[model samples]
Target: MTADLGARRASICPEPPFNALFNIRMPFIYPTSQLSLERKTPVVSTANVGQLAVDLIIASLSLQRVAILESGYCVPVVGAREDGQKGITTALELYGHPGVDFVVIQQRSPVLKVGAYSLVCLDARSALRLQSRKEEFIKALLNFIKDSKFGAVLFLSGVDLSNRTDSQMTTPTYQIRPENSPTLAGTALQRLSSLPIPKYTSPVSQEAQPAESSSSTPFIPGGGITRRILSSLPSEWSVPTASILQFVLEGDNRADAGLLASVVVKILGKEVPQWRQPGSWRDGLFGTPHDQTLFG
Candidate 1:
């Protein structure tokens, strides 16, 4: 029998209630860590929280962003790859020279810039070694974002494309938000749909799923705690967010990055700069190394 997609969705990620509280629980078993919460703050410079000056923040919570950087170029890494935190200090790098001028925040997470947008190459894996420091790191990251006064935040995540199909569709996998429509949420979704990439359709086939499961909690699976942090931002903050998750077959994802970047630029009412074409991306290093490296 085909299990309903809504049923599978509810089992996977329940919708948070109107007055729901934050779920501080970690979903996976973490190895022991020596660092304490206080020690983690030094990685995040409280001095220049809003220095980015960009109007939008684009993030990848899948943690693959780390490997793409470790390879030194946008080329695909051969062998098995995975996601999640590596270590505390391992997570902090203020200035990175991985062929790109990516600014490290809170020690390990990296951020790059394109015109008015700030692309956050977040390694969700690093947060694992944080231990009791997770909450503190999240607070610091949020404060830094708040200081930026960005109009909106967009999280670009990757979902596993195993067992089933549609890996090459180029459609975004999931978008997280409250059940009821906020004006900004509606506007953001509408603008995002206007982008030229395909998006996931409701009611996936039942044979595609592994099995039925249940979870009372509502959350983003691969996103790690970053989703929780983004979801918990208070309403008064007025910074709307849209997380565009794409499906990948576990290799180089530069093509996915290009599709996501284009969607993001469109959502922000900006054009994909003419120089970002796939043909020129290899030589147009400043354009988008993330995408160019994959197909260029």
Candidate 2:
């Protein structure tokens, strides 16, 4: 699937302006408030563990919903609110407190992958549409960071634990910064370098490294679009971008989420508040206990 998607993507042209792609909706207005989004940071989470970590952050901080991003790139989804609110939630939304210096983007659905529907015998037009959606999504996100004048952007994701090498066994967390990042050196992001966490080393063999690796982008196995998204950001933009990665396997990851969230808070230089699990997690997050009677 990766190879197939790569081949299709190679022929595609660059993305157009973001205004032509999607519309952003901010339903709640704070007219009399002193809240300002300018120069604030944005913590963007990918699917899986990253999403879970963002969920923990939102609940812990008691952040408010700020915006709903409408994009065709993600698979359509709707579910009961994670915050135990009265309404349903969509695939993508933003949350933040006016007093906070950072906003969190919670992605509730995975981005559409053309390979998943390839076997469905999609027509050429349909295939093109799928590919465009992904490109537009990335472009829209990058454009948002630029338009909003964010101080910096942090991306979060999880890599496959099985891909870890001997050296990586020491720590479950790692980070990746764009090679020669112009904006990260003097910023708070620079503090991440002093932490115990090591820089992410791609597990891909030198011989089989993809073309993107030439630009010094880390290949993150099972990280879902993280590498792709980071690679898309040009260093000249100087947005002080960095990604925090956790090594993880499938199944219960609540503990992993908590640990990752702590690391993120440390990087952001924020006080770690008492942890609060989202209400949605109470709904059989670990699944129903096995019936003891069956063992008899």
Candidate 3:
């Protein structure tokens, strides 16, 4: 019965186009509402910390779903609705409050990592495809930001805690801005600079840094695509962009998400509202509770 159901579903769902990554098809953004996004700041989420922080922001600010982002770069996923919404949710979606100065792009699934899987399967072709997909995705996203006329863009990510230096141990959060970005004063990036958070310095030793020492391109270990996206921006680009990141180890990171979300709120100069955990977090986030009867 299960095999039959799986076959039926597979037949119903169309297969992704061949050479889709190589062809570089542009992602489609479908707006569900009449919300004007012009001049609004956008927060792009990456890594676990970023995703969870975005979730907290949506719940706290009561941000509504404004658009759905259809992209081939991400692994296709559909599951129960987030934030207690009625219908199912897809891999990527946009959320925002009407009058709020900032919006968020929540990525519910990780980027397609065919290369990692290819190692196990020993298929070199899959590795090449992964690289192409990632590059195309970055190009598509940057083009969208440039055309959207947004006031600024913020990226959130998590750095590997193991890479932290002794000095960095005092502060778990850090900020990175492209040196070439002509960010003016009073912008969200500048506002974040005013905070006590330390600027991210590459952990690589000076001897090893000579090869990748461009100040404009930062090294962010464990921050998936954060550095790539920032470095890919053209030097002549006018949009202001920055990344806020936290050093975290994989585990129950709910507390880390809260702290990072607070920093984001501060950067926007908005009063931090009472954070309400989404229904998904409260219910089965970690998994079903262990039965005490086992111990007995």
Candidate 4:
């Protein structure tokens, strides 16, 4: 059978726009790649694809125009703890270089949410019957990263089988709450890992009870300027874990966003120079991070 390019069309992924999510300004770095490092194809776990997406966006952008229709769903990892869910995002934004496009966030309500990525949402506050101030602050920071014209994101709500379809894409995805992903909530990225959507039945947890929250504690702290400008986030959005990457690629839809991201990485790795690792650099001259090849 012959391949059909014209007959095939890309899915119209409608995620959030950039700049809408960020409440503060942060620095970002966008490096241009000279060598492609794909001596072998890159395989990722859908369960942890959140991290893969970050790597892909950073690497691909350095080489060429990069776009991801991230439809990886997720479960919860961390939330607004009583320790005062304030300023954590502030600590993170200081790290990124100022050159991104969007931090798209798409979801299908309680169906599925990204458990790995760090973010703020109304759920965090409401989980304790409090206003979602902290979640809003995180959202603001996310918008800043996306609006920089650097990159974009497509956050999808809901899960597979349960929702019946992969992406209903109700709300738009934005970078208001995007952060250094694959937070402690997610597992580390490895060549060998599980994919998203378990092939077998996962052990069901017993009935759970949530911790109590204090209402007096504003969803955020007493930062007058920060609090004044940012609005509370709605309970609709969520950040997912990075592990979903591998699963989406190998899931029911072989050609969904997860597979597309993998294919994109493979394609870019083929032509780009950075994908190929350069020889070890001068030992002390630069003290730069070396590329740790996974498998040959």
| Per-model CA lDDT versus the true structure | 0.35, 0.77, 0.79, 0.26
Per-candidate TM equals 0.40, 0.79, 0.82, 0.24
TM-score quality measure for candidate 1 = 0.40
Among these predicted structures, which one has the highest lDDT? Answer: 3
Estimate candidate 3's alpha-carbon lDDT, on a 0 to 1 scale: 0.79
> How does residue 260 of candidate 4 score in lDDT?
38
TM-score of 3: 0.82
lDDT of 4: 0.26
lDDT of 2 by residue, 1-296 (tens): 87776555544433433533453333222222244668888999985999999999999998877777763568998888765676677788878887788988889888776411121112222232334456567777888778778788899999999988998888999999876355576665666878888888887564576546666687888998898888888767768888999999998999999999999999988886599999878774775678999999
Q: Candidate 3: RMSD over Cα atoms?
A: 7.9
Q: Comparing 1 and 2 by lDDT, which wins?
A: 2
Ranking of models by TM-score: 3, 2, 1, 4
lDDT digits (tens) for residues 1-296 of candidate 4? 12343223111222222432343333332223322221211222222233334333334444221222122222323222112434211111111122322222211112132222223334223111222433443454344333433222222211222312234232111111223322323211221122223221111121231221221111111112121122222233232222121223223331243333443334223233433211211231146666777443
| Tens digit per residue, CA lDDT, model 1, 241-293 | 45555555444455555654455445555443341323222442245546566
lDDT of model 2 at position 296: 100
